[model samples]
Target chain A: MSRLELRHMRKAFGGLEVLADISLRVDAGEFVSILGPSGAGKSTLFQLLTGAEHGEGEMFFDGAPLDDHGRHFAFMPQRDALMPWRRILDNTTLGLEVQGLGRKAARTRVAPLFAEFGLAGFERHFPAQLSGGMRQRAALLRTVVQERDMLLLDEPFGALDALTRAAMQRWLEQMWRHHRWTALLITHDVREAVFLSDRIYVLSARPARVVREIQVPLPRPRDPTSAATRQAGVLEAEILDILLNLQPTKGHDHD
Target chain B: MASSSFNPRQLAGFLAQAAPAVISIGLVLVAWELYANHSGIKPTVLPAPSRVFEQAMLNRDALLDNAIPTIRATLIGFACSLSAAFALSMLVDFFQPLRRALFPVFIVSQTLPLVAIAPLVVLWFGFGLTPKIMLVALVTFFPMLVALVQGYEATEVEIGQMLRAMGAGRWRVFILARLPSALPYFFAGLRISITYAVVGAIFAEYAGAAKGLGIYMLNAKNNFRPDLVLAAVGVSAALTLVLFGLTVVLQRLAMPWERAAGRRAARKGPQA
Candidate 1:
């Protein structure tokens, strides 16, 4: 079990500030979501979390200052980002391979999870052969197989069709329950945040600050049409109202 | 499409595609024969195709002996150059400063005339296999090295980032991402280099060689046997065609995706 905490995270690119004093926390085994409008510097925040880009912030994992960014977290970029030349099994084993696992051992480790990820027959297939949904599953498998302290997902399901995205979100929720791993997802999809996260942090546009923190009062095993899901929807609407109000004012301020 | 069976329609289509080139070549040969018969020029100056063919048949033993050395030199030189180019490209890919330093040198080296250098090589190395191999290696190295460097650069940025995010080291990223991506480009360069390999071998031999098509041509020209010279030329062309075909076959075997992609594109038609 791993809990993640960020304090007063600030980022700037040249003179254009992207993130400003953003703070958030995720308890052990909890799923948290960052929902913001497009170009709200969510990617910038992810880059900071993954140590791809440096930002002025204090990050802690389970009460320890998060150092050695390489080993601590698994990062899934916005795209599937699987190696096109590799077979699905090989791609899935990449994280393990990077961690100095031998070919035979990595293969042994990942072979069983292919079926669990709905990719059993596709172990030998290349990335291009799979659908968008399957590719994301493989990408997720590649991320999760590493068994890192936390998973950072950047728009993992944003590219999928609505139905596929819904199914993947459900699948992800099921996996989350099974593993109980801490996950921080960056997304622009309010419904997705409402459906999958225990808490959602809504950010304003550029120089993004956490404007609202909404605890999802809805219970688990949320059906798409159930009262709990509707309650989550009400929360989603409330967040949407905040965003709609902020956009015009934010646009005027930018100019 | 079955490998075991021959379809008549397919055979007809193949013949139809080949007919135009065959007919044009036949016409050229006929015209040359007519000119040779009527112009009253010495056969030594401009031997007809028939005489060249006859000379080739008559001198088969000597031609084969000479042809073997030329083929051997070309193959050896090409292999050496391929290995060297691959190593250099990998180095350039690994070291950022090396690319900055080496790319200009690579471009400059390509501009050096083989004619001016071949004699100097022959002078330095003597009339043995060494000069011939060096010339071929020099001529074949540039295209493949450039192709490989460009291919390395062409690796998808997102994929590389993803690998890095997974905690891959520089060498691992290259082995996993860059090398495989560079293959198609390497083969493209191989096609150019393979053609140059034969020509380079013959030119080096021309400067001075004990045996090979270059030596055979020199002897034939000195003996005023234009037909024999043309026959040697024919053999060199055949060797080049054979090597080029081999490269194509090897490329197809190595990159099945290229063929599959082509078929997929054909099926999908054009995209807007």
Candidate 2:
């Protein structure tokens, strides 16, 4: 059975529909990427999946329907979104802290992860002290530390420079493989979608629908610079063409 | 770069910035002294700074005797104002309807000139500490309320979403996210309110009081003791400076991050 199922999910902001009749199933430990252009409702779909907004949908997690009071997924937004006042360690352990875990216990659990993530000495440093790449790593650590089966990431590496972004993608893939997590990533970068995802769901413009789902048959332990990885580049171009065609006319576009 | 050598240019720059204010104050004091001598102004009419200092020395015991009561009142009034304003701000933040209903009333209360209302407060509460404390709370509350509301409202949507995604409740979000972000605003409001606290207490004392700087000024006026009045004025100015200085100290302690940013800016020198 799939770990997460979104059946006919629909979301509208007043008269404007953002996600329309989107249905998909994510199996346990599957990595899926929702790719589209800007304002293509990829983030909106992530929001809907994670219950960021109430929408018409049937969402089941681990074969159980998600109730109003229960949470089954950890969500990481496009930005780092770290609490500026909190120390790096405290920020990473916030999810557990909110779950009624004592500070000592939460810190105990997060201590090893800090060393694993290359954040050992900077545990006491606040978010402002960290560089952009480090901040994103801390944010990812925060999401993962919650121990949720499904991780919903919205443009996680979209803000980084090209080199940093590539490094983060490789690091994230390593982390994902190590823990074997089910994740749904939203990104405007088609290459990112193809490289990171096992299967890619391409979303159309606002009032978005999944227009295409491309299965990535790339070999495991995918080397970013290898010729086999260049196959993913071909897939990226095809997705880009679809996204470009989906852009609305000037008069129809509204923020 | 590793050397800890002194920079003569930096010292000169510091002195250059301070020179104007120091010279301006000296000129003002000299002009006052000269005008008093030329006009044959009686010490009773408008005493020179020297005469004011002399009077301050002579009446040192008397000034201290009156100062204790006034200082006590000011401290009590300021404490009352701070607590009341904090609680009211929290209340306004917690409930939307209460905020909508009382915000306008608070604004309207501020517009009702304190000079006009001081006498009424004194009449209602008598010449005790109650009236003075109420007046200080009244004057200091609005700025703090406005500041706090704006600060609470300024919580970033991204941060709020992050907290929500972690399954944190509204109160949890507020306590963790909103409260810390609002610290600078609260400190700013406190700084502004500190000035108002001193003025409000003195104004209330002026309307009806037997002690305080305000009463001392009134007595000096009636007795034609201009030097004593000037001395009292100097004390009031000193009090304001002390309160403002305390705010700066509190802000530094509360927001080390801001101070770090400020130091960085200072090190960077002027930016075009």
True contacts kept of each: 0.38, 0.40
Decoy 2 TM-score against native:
0.90
Model 2 residue runs over 4 Å out of place are: A68-70, A250-255, B1-23, B260-272
> Residues B1-272, candidate 2, lDDT per residue (tens digit)?
12474688877997999899989999999999988878997877878888888889999887877666667777788787667777777777788789889988988989999879999999999988888888888898788878887788778788888788778888998898887878888888988888888888888888888778778878888888888988888887788888898888887777766644444345543211
Each candidate structure's count of clashing pairs = 0, 0
Is model 1 an incorrect, acceptable, medium or high docking prediction? acceptable
Tens digits of lDDT, candidate 1, B8-73: 877999899999999998999999988987899889899989888998999999999999999999
- Every model's TM-score: 0.86, 0.90
* Off by more than 4 A, model 1: A14-16, A161-163, A248-255, B1-51, B222-226, B256-272
In Å, residue B29's CA in model 2 sits off its true spot by 2.7
